[model samples]
Target: MNVPELFEEGWYWTSTQYSPNLAWSQSFDDGLQGNLVKDYEGRVRVVRRFPLN
Candidate 1:
């Protein structure tokens, strides 16, 4: 897909995490899947998914 399409899909996924009406908690399941970690300033962050087995 093009960059714009990819960005829109990403935005949709991120927004779902903030939805209050979802049946389950929307926080990332770190234990179930590895994630892409980035260091911003002094803080470590997981901004994307890693390989899922």
Candidate 2:
């Protein structure tokens, strides 16, 4: 079964704060993760996890 199917080829923002000028980001298609300038505009993804315990 398909889950969370928002798989679009684009960059997304992450909560991992890098610095005053850059922030962490990730891609959905190519699986590229890196930092980009704070002024750069990209897609955002907010995720939540449930404990298996």
Candidate 3:
């Protein structure tokens, strides 16, 4: 098993959208998660896992 290396932590977006003007995000720094406005500045990290066939 291998662990991914993480650099400077930042907030990441979530699919859990709040209303039409807000969205949910997670902070990798302290695991601080909250709902923030869409305009709030944040970093986006996307990943996918493939199953062995």
- lDDT winner: 2
Report clash pairs, candidate 2. none
Give lDDT tens digits, candidate 1, residues 1-53. 12332232211122222234332112232322222222211222335656765
Candidate 1, lDDT over the whole model: 0.26
What overall lDDT, based on C-alpha atoms, would model 3 receive against the true structure? 0.79
Per-candidate Cα lDDT values, in order, are 0.26, 0.83, 0.79
- What is candidate 2's lDDT per residue for 1-53, written digit by digit as tens? 23547656788999888998899999887888999998998988667767664
Error of 3 at 39 (Å): 0.6
- Measured by TM-score, how close is model 2 to the native structure? 0.79
Residue-level lDDT tens digits of model 3 in 1-53:
23335625888888789889999988887878999999988877765667766
Question: TM per model?
Answer: 0.14, 0.79, 0.69
Quantify how close model 1 is to the true structure by its C-alpha RMSD in Å: 12.8
The candidate maximizing TM-score is 2
Provide the lDDT at 12 for model 3: 85
Ranking by lDDT: 2, 3, 1
